[model samples]
Target: MKKLLNYFFQGLLVVIPISVTIVVIYKIIFWIDGLLPFQLPVKLPGIGEVNIPGLGILTIVVGITIFGYFAKFFVANPFFLLLERLLERTPLLKIIYTSVKDLIEAFVGEKKRFNQPVLVTVNKESQVQRIGFITKNDLTEIGISNQKLAVYLPFSYGFNGQLVIVPSENVEKINASGTEMMKFVISGGVTEVD
Candidate 1:
């Protein structure tokens, strides 16, 4: 029963924030859509005229973009600082929150950590290589040798991954874009890189 309760808390820690975010975004989209006064119907190439919630969607999208700009320029820093301070007061919650936050930020934040995709030689004897992103090129700050790098090897069909410290010489930078490489890795190499 204790183990089950532990699992429940872990699930809540992961699910609640994501669920709340989705719900909030859903509410915001519909609320803004309701405020828009006009709908433009346009003729398509093949099909008849279709009513696109054109301006409402556009307004929401543009509004979100502008909001993001302002958030980055003026609001987000202080807001997140305060939020992180509050989260730090709680022990377990702080770990979960920061981990999830950093993971999200790694992909979409201003400081994208997964941009440098590379092929890591995991087993030299078998000539086995794994696709990963170089998250930290210099691990010296963490007392790791500067000759090693931190590579994040994403698992197939999952958001979770393993981080490995490999010698810089064994890491080969790939020509593919981050998104393409991520897609290929997540699809278990089934997806073609374009």
Candidate 2:
């Protein structure tokens, strides 16, 4: 009975994560695919003039590529400037919008803030350290202390996180990639950083 239960548990551990990952990817693909003009589609070689699946995704990829090209060269487009000015006027909206935008940019923008993982010393005398992502390397941009760098520490096995600013000297940059570090943090070290 003990061996049988152990095997069952091991099997579950292998199956559940793989199943969830596949299911989530499938759902996300379909959700993005649903964003297209479902009624209109171009004719394909084998499919004829049918509204093929993943057309929406292809459209989005192309649209993003064009947008990125413009944004990279322009730096500050007129449309984006107008939107920023509009958001800044609204007190509540500005705060929410800026925070969300910064978060998104950190993850997938030119800045790529979270790519640098660090070991921050929380207790110097005790030598206590924590792993974190460097969200902001220069606090002076926000008119904060120049000696400090902002880091985001994620909770293990949870979505919760803490944002802190520590002295740059206390942070030792790690060799791990952002994706590997995030996986380790989220899995509470239960999963390997492969």
Candidate 3:
């Protein structure tokens, strides 16, 4: 009886979050669809209104595909270069364009180093420590050399609350998978493998 109760509660934990996420996403899409003046014709002959779900996501995909197709051929062409020069001459548009372009490139670029994971020490004593990933490496004349690693320590509940840099020797690289490590952290040390 106790085992069955535990299984029921575990199923509830999984189902509730997934259902809530889908409902929230659907509501947001409905709200955005309300903002647009466009409407799809009713599916049935006499139906009043019919709306498609996830149209916003489809629109984003189509836009990105078109932009990528254009960018691939025009990025290095002389005509496109001239247009880019003209756009850069504008003060306000130049700033906004550069900012957005850089942000998108950082998100989609191959050289983005922040997503690369690395192990780091959290506290002074090695016994009580947590897993973290490297965010940046500092190489400065006044302070630490180029060898220092900055790590972002994520909290158990969600997201990050602490950031620190530890020397290379203090960190012990583990052979566990990232998903396994995340499970350990999310369980607040209740789950671990020998």
User: TM-score per candidate, in order?
Assistant: 0.61, 0.69, 0.61
TM-score preference between candidates 1 and 2, better one: 2
- Candidate No. with top lDDT: 1
Which stretches of model 1 miss by more than 4 angstroms? 1-70, 73-80
Please tell me which predicted candidate would have the highest TM-score against the true structure: 2
Stretches > 4 Å off in candidate 3: 1-7, 31-44, 77-107, 126-128, 141-143, 156-163, 174-194
Deviation (Å) of 146 in candidate 1: 0.9
Over 4 Å off, model 2: 1-6, 26-77, 140-144
Report per-prediction Cα RMSD to one decimal: 14.5, 4.2, 5.1
Please count the clashing residue pairs in each candidate, in the order shown.
0, 0, 0
What are the lDDT scores of the predictions, listed in order?
A: 0.88, 0.86, 0.68
Writing each residue's lDDT as its tens digit, candidate 3 over 1-194 gives: 99999999999999997999999888987776666566544475677666676665566568789998998988898988988888788999899887676646544665443454456655666556667655566646538666676666667866444767777665665676545665666666577744
lDDT of 2 by residue, 41-101 (tens): 7788887887655668878999999988887887587888898899988999999998898
Better model by lDDT: candidate 1 vs candidate 2:
1
lDDT tens digits by residue: candidate 1, 35-146: 7776556799899887654457777789889988887787558777787798977899989988888888998998799999999999999999999999988888999999
What clash pairs does model 3 have?
none
